[model samples]
Target chain A: MENLYDVVIIGAGPAGLAAGLYSARAKMKTLILEKDKAGGQIVTTNEVANYPGSIDDATGPSLVARMVEQAESFGAERKKDEIVKVELQDKIKVVTGEKDVYKAKVVIIATGASPRYLGVPGERELTGKGVSYCATCDADFFTDLEVYVIGGGDTAVEEAMYLTKFARKVTVVHRRDELRAAKSIREKAFNNEKMAFIWDSVVEEIKGDGIVEKLVLKNKKTGEITEIDAPEEDGTFGIFPFVGYIPKSELFKDFLETDKGGYLITDPDMKTAVPGVFAAGDIRHKSLRQVVTAVADGAIAAVQAEKYIENTFEN
Target chain B: MVILEKDNFEEEVLNSKGLVIVDFWSDGCEPCKALMPEVEALAEKYEGKVKFCKLNITKARRLAISQRVMGLPTILLYKDGAKIEEVTKDEAKAANIEAMIEKHI
Candidate 1:
């Protein structure tokens, strides 16, 4: 028989975990389903200084470990299963996973977002070898080495600054003449001695043999192409792409209302247009998508879910 | 404590007094992201009188499916926690949302 739950949460990221914590603590039979490993984006991040009341030594994994422990302690059952489909119209919600099918009275979603990559040559092959999307994860490997950063956004500029702590020098390459980052961050990058800019430029291709050894740069304004060789001392360098992120919501395209870029919408209470559905975390269409905000969304979603079950299913 | 899961969202919001507005959106939706500030503005504008919230479909696929949301950026309005109106993509403008809130509040 399929085990029935009071709440079934998708994804084990901060939002999902938070929802699990709140729901289970409220005495709801909650189950958290994660497609892969838990921790979400925090697993790839190195430092987490912004979370309020967080420990000073809190790294991404460390914080997530604590959250997981907390949620488990509160009686939230977690399983590693990819949800394939769902039947949510009835009073009881059914979630079908790759391994098993489960039922729940309520569901919370917190899948989070995935990194967007530059689809250039050698990118897919050289990932983790020399090419990376997160500077915090790969910065230590490139101590005193030169690094190239793509994009002109706040994340790009901030990551470039973070890279300066380990990299010998950091070069920012943008397709436009000017950076699109905030003025303060741009000013900080400008003042940093280790930071340099390649304006009106785009990375046409990433080339290397087993590792990144050279880059093919294209001047957008002038259309000039040049192959910049890696420094001889290191034989190779790191390339960090800070282009953007795409939400992992392909499975939901058919049912959910999405925007042009495919983000999900929600009201302030985290409820969907449909009577019994709710959403939360980075997956929601929100302006700021930090860890703090995701956790907040989870807490709110859990509370709402509790009330939903109590009133409608009390009979 | 409130648990905002799929089963209980309707009861929680509808049972509460005053206007209840729900924004349905997803990640990777540019226009949805663009309209966030406007939604937040509405939340702030009607803070004391109205209750506002958001639902992400990508993360909450089951919930979205249950609700029968068919597109990006749908909004729902509830009075006393029962859904009274649904705002389609074309009707998701701030003016319309505001008008809906005005009717309930």
Candidate 2:
């Protein structure tokens, strides 16, 4: 087939782009298919301090741009198409996108995760009105207003801190008494005067009329419920949820074996159970999900794919 | 696509006749910036049939809120000066916006 590729990676995030850089540099005809524009979830993130070897104040989009440039320089072709189906059992995989179908000797699945919603009432109806997942995207809308952040993880704390810059008061509501974020981030959150915490609590419901007007919070341990109404002057408050993520594995769930959390199961070398099919980045079942680890997974998956192609496809 | 300011928003979108799509964006929103070219391409495709305009929320905060746009990268489809549909955040993908345009136009 004219569209046949040595390796067709299924995303343009950190892992897929890094895989492109590696596999293409190895002289493989690599193609990276992305549903959206490049950068994935990282693009929504503002700061990326923990990425090693990054220069001072490296932003997520800047880092992804460099990665995209490097991958393209190495001759990795990219396309913007959402894959609707995948036939992975055969020797030659057939990936069907909305625009076209592609054949590949080796397929790297790098479809990443998306922000998990709180699933509380009114969250769906008022998503654009007041509830948001991307702080960098919506912070400016809440300038000088009160904002509530949902979650206690790294992203939740970091985003809550970021919201403090725009919102008058930023409060983090966690189901646990203590935060699950890193020590340094926890210390920073504790020290910020504008930041506050609602421990052992979860949002029971978000109430609004045309916009976010009130939030009903329930304490997990004490069984106490409290309702916070929007300030009369402002008429609305912002609710940001950074709780967790849901892997974008809906397309491959039937063909691939995923963990309980829907993360694809992969060996140490990023090889999935299916031959010639590998999974990497946030989609893979791993202990840590970070940019550094995702890039490492991508590099390993590419190298392993090359080895697999040499042994199995060469005849 | 017409870049709208507070002064001419009504003239360009609300008061305009037929179908109109407004891209609610800002300088700091990365997705909004990334989706710009795609939106512009759509504008070129549907040139005379649909009116496409972009508003920077940073410069027109009150106007954006008045239109009930509280999030970034929001695409609102207006028919006869009334908002018929909207997609925001992750739903504001190029394919989805294109589908929205096709459905209304």
Candidate 3:
């Protein structure tokens, strides 16, 4: 088709931006479509430590800004569009954003996942007030306040420990009697004086006025419900849930091979079961979900897309 | 882009003859800072069709309070003199802003 881009990348996080950079560098016509800001979830993060070769004391926004500049400098065009549909059954794929439609030879899916919510009452309304998913973003707001963290996974426990640095006390409320986090992480949480745990329990509701004031917890073993109020003089408390993430793969479910959790399944080369279509970042069914891994996935998907186009259409 | 103040809130936004988008932001709000570039870009693209403006809450706290604005980076879409939609939390996203514009203007 006329004016078809070589690769159209969905989302503008590290993975999508990296793919754009690689595809553009390979002399392919690339366009990166982002539903939100350029940085994705990383923009909410205040600091990043683990990414290799990152500058000392690098912030998440700073890191993402540099990556985006590099990608655009290499000739990747970026646009803001909320994609509503996709037609992936043909050699040349069709992707529809709310504002525009696009045709592409290859499509890279990197619409990253978001943190899973607890689905309890008041949780949604109190999100920015006192409920948060990322401690890195909202921890400082809760300094010296009592906080409750819900989950048993590595991220939950790890974040609980991290919150102790800001909150006066952090109580971990998990569904099971024990934690599912790594042993080392568990040890750190148990030893911390500011950290505590509520076993075999789940939060039934989060109640607050203009801010979070109380939580209703249910003891799974005893079938008892109890109300935990914010400490006197505090008037409100913080609730941080780190249950896990839900992949942003609803639009591609019928077209691409995906795991039960809705994460797109891709080969090691980032190629999906459908030829010329690839998946990357947290949307991919992979182990690590960090900036480093996302960048690597993006690079591979672009290079693979380039090879696919060269072999199929060019020569 | 219009810089909204307490005195011009009515004339520039409410009493305007066209569709208007007023971004209520603060100086140190990181998300607001992150969204300004996108807002500026959209202002250029939507110039003459839709009005884009900003009001610094730090300078116009009374106007912000009068509008019941509880958070930073709140984007309000106004059709003529009536406020139609408000994006309070995820207003930093350009797509979300664009979708609102597409839905109305």
Candidate 2 Cα outliers beyond 4 Å, as residue runs: none
TM-score of each candidate? 0.70, 0.97, 0.80
> Could you tell which candidate, 1 or 2, scores higher by TM-score?
2
DockQ of 2: 0.72
The CA lDDT of each predicted structure is 0.78, 0.93, 0.85
Q: What's the best-to-worst order under lDDT?
A: 2, 3, 1
Worst lDDT run of 10 residues, candidate 1 chain A, spans A134-143
Q: After superposition, how far is residue B16 of candidate 3 from its true place, in Å?
A: 16
The TM-score that candidate 1 achieves is 0.70
Candidate 3 pairs with clashing backbones: none
Query: Hey, what RMSD does candidate 1 come out at?
Result: 21.8
DockQ of each: 0.01, 0.72, 0.17
Q: Candidate 2, residues B14-77: lDDT per residue as tens digits? A: 8889999999998778889878898999999999999999999987887888899999889999
* Weakest ten-residue segment in model 1 chain B by summed lDDT: B26-35
Q: What is the lDDT of residue A202 in candidate 1?
A: 85
User: What tens-digit string does per-residue lDDT give for candidate 1 at A1-315?
Assistant: 359899999999899999999999999999999875688877656657679999896877778888999999999999977788987677788889878998988877788888788988888766755677756445655677899999999888888998899789999999898999989889999999999999998888888876688899999889999898989977778888888889877766567776777777888988766556678898899999888999899999999999998889896
Error of 2 at A178 (Å): 0.9
Candidate 2: residue pairs that collide: none
How many steric clashes between backbone atoms does each model show?
53, 0, 0
lDDT of 1 by residue, B1-105 (tens): 122456666666756766677777655343355456678899899877777788765556446434544344567787776678766543566777888777766
